[model samples]
Target: MITIQNLDKAFAKQKVLSDVTIKIADGEKVLLLGHNGAGKTTLIRCLLGEYRPDHGTVTVAGHSLAHERVAALRKIAFVPQLPPPIRFTLNELFEYAAKIGHCDIDKIRKNSIYFGLNTDAHDHKAFYKLSGGMKQKTLISIAFSRDADIFIFDEPTANLDTMGRDRFRERISADAMKEKTIIFIGHRLEELSSVVTRIIELDLGKVIRDEQA
Candidate 1:
């Protein structure tokens, strides 16, 4: 389980998040909703231990984000808003991530198919050469391959086409059935309705709504 209490963060003179408290039970699927600059990304960063909270605490699977960064990261896999810089082919990237994440190649290959990645294209082309949707698919494939207890994704559907968006949600739904905790940050609530079990809305760094969908 993840427990966040009184979380606060600020940048320069502006507060990005304040007194934010939330709890995510194991296996729960949550959608984080907010406009641009509403702190969704900031909150995900804090949860991933990429940014330290100015005050308060965040605990994931019993490990505190501030005290046990590596331990905390071990339990979570994060996909950022921007796709990762593809300095190599999709296969090479997957091999590197699997080695570091200790994931199985067979499983990663399966996820690659699940994400609609053309094995031939991904196998031969450099990541930078793939289309935007393909890059996002590769990013998601890497995240799922980690097999972490929790997954955090920010703006995952941004560059996807209609079919790609549907396929992405389908993959998410399938993953959720495996009982992994998923925290997704996105502007499109309608697209997430089918897979998201709960919704948390943020405005100017404060959580304004928390409700089951």
Candidate 2:
């Protein structure tokens, strides 16, 4: 489970998140909805321990994020909204991710293949050289390959093609994934409606609505 209590965040004295409190239970499929500057990304960053909250606490799977950042992060797998500008080639990236994440490179390769990404041909190519869709596919593959208690995807399908998007939706909606704690941040709610058990909407830096779908 993930817990956030009385969370508040600000940048250069500008408040971005205010008194945000939320609880995410295990095996819940949650859709985090919000427009730009609504604090959605900030909230995610806080949850991932990228940004320390000015006030309040964040606990993930019973571990305090403030006190145990690395341990807390080990329990989550995340696919960011945009791929990072990494200098490593596909092969190097996979090896590094496998080593650091303690995940199987084979499983990541399998997932990439399942997503129609030709990792073999792209192995020697730098990650930054890949097209947006390919980068997205690789990130998705890596995230899915990891063994984590929570999976968070931010605009995961934004760069995918129609078929690629459908494939992603199918994979995430599979029965095997039904029991996982998943959080999705996307504009296209219909694409994930079938798998989302609950919806939480944030606006003006606070949660305005949260209910079962």
Best by TM-score: 2
Instruction: Evaluate model 1: give its lDDT.
Output: 0.85
What would the TM-score be for candidate 1 when compared with the true structure? 0.91
C-alpha lDDT values of all predictions: 0.85, 0.91
Residue pairs with backbone atoms closer than 3 Å in model 2 (clashes): none
Flag regions of model 1 displaced more than 4 Å.
122-124, 175-178
Q: Tell me the alpha-carbon RMSD of every candidate.
A: 1.9, 1.0
Which parts of model 2 are misplaced by more than 4 Å? none
Tens-digit lDDT string for candidate 2 (125-187)? 999999999999999989988888799999899899887798899988888787799999977
Q: Which candidate's lDDT is highest?
A: 2
Among all windows of ten consecutive residues in candidate 2, which has the lowest summed lDDT?
A: 171-180
TM-score of every candidate relative to the true structure: 0.91, 0.97
For residues 1-213, write the lDDT of model 1, one tens digit per residue.
999899999999899999999999988889999889999988988988888999999998889989998898896888788775678877888788888889987787888787778877558788888888888878887888786888888888898777768777777778455598889888778888887889999999999999988
